[model samples]
Target: MNLFRLSKGFITEVHRLFALFWWESSDVEKRLHWGSWDKLCESKNDGGLGFCDLSLFNQAMLAKHCWRFIKWPNSLVVRVIKGRYFPTSDFLHATKCSSDSFVWKSFMWGRELIEAGSRWQIGNRSSTLIYEDRWIPRRHSFKVQSPRVLGRDAKVRLLLNTSAKEVEAILSIPTGSNLDDYLLWHFEKDGNYSLKSGYKLG
Candidate 1:
């Protein structure tokens, strides 16, 4: 006397369950159709019947992490999992499976696809160099190229400011020179200029 018993078996049971939740005839029909499970889960805008199976949706959501791991294997979450459970290898073998659940395998497959298309860039704001879509050790050190000062006055100011003592030492060279040049040279060499005294470059 299980009251829910029907000649159509599981399909009838599913339909009955849908009925209790206020689904219309069209919804029941869509759920009953033996189409691709993925298509059935999609939104109606994508041309699929909008029937969400929550358990499947949860699995799919968690499956995204698999892709994240493959994209950034050295990321914090992946690192923790690698340290705690996968210490011995980069790739997890089927036999050594810790979880061994079907959902976990599905996630791993998604990760594999992400890993195949991964690429990297190395450089600063001014320029960048691209690297292959594989896990290779980074061998080169990157540094920002010193920007060149453009205007003549700006260049003089830059030279004056950077390594001021060195510039003053160079200007102090006793080779015969013009009065203006000689006076300017002495001003810097004596380290008596107001700007030099006021600013502590370091």
Candidate 2:
């Protein structure tokens, strides 16, 4: 489930089996379902059995692979995939190709979930785009809401007015150290992606 994308029918069948087990139904006799499957999948705090939604769980598992791509860009798998599918671009910006393999396609599918929950943490600011990337510390949509005055290629560093000390209040702080800008899972305090959070987000 983590490495491959399961079909909807397969997941449905698995859920059906799970339901039978939960209700203690045998092959000879069927038991009445006490509640809807949706309710059963809800959190225990919300009066549910807290059963894992297989489809969402599968997505969460796959999202972990995508998260790994971002967290470990230098890994062998990422390097090979980058060389083949996105030689000139990155995982976030890569588009699906007609000739892509099944495994790569599955990884891309996982990437969609990663996109929903991940955001950029500004450090060096060279990679953090001022408008396109999510860097602003806002509630929803961590992007610049103002009209664009800078070019599309403008980085967060470009917005910093390091030339004047007084302009610091109006702009983002300058690159304090040599740390590189990186992606973060905003749902976690440690800024790391976890299956539990990914499942909930899904």
Best by TM-score: 2
Q: Write the per-residue lDDT of candidate 1 for residues 94-143, one digit (tens) a residue.
A: 22355655544555544332333221221121111212112122112111
How much is the lDDT of residue 168 in candidate 2? Answer: 34
- What tens-digit string does per-residue lDDT give for candidate 2 at 75-155? 998999889988888788889988989888888888878888887887877788877887665434566666777888899
Model 2 stretches with alpha carbons more than 4 Å out:
138-140, 146-150, 158-177
State the local distance difference test value for candidate 1: 0.37
In terms of lDDT, the poorest run of 10 residues in model 2 is: 161-170
lDDT of 2: 0.81
Which 10 successive residues of model 1 have the least lDDT summed? 193-202
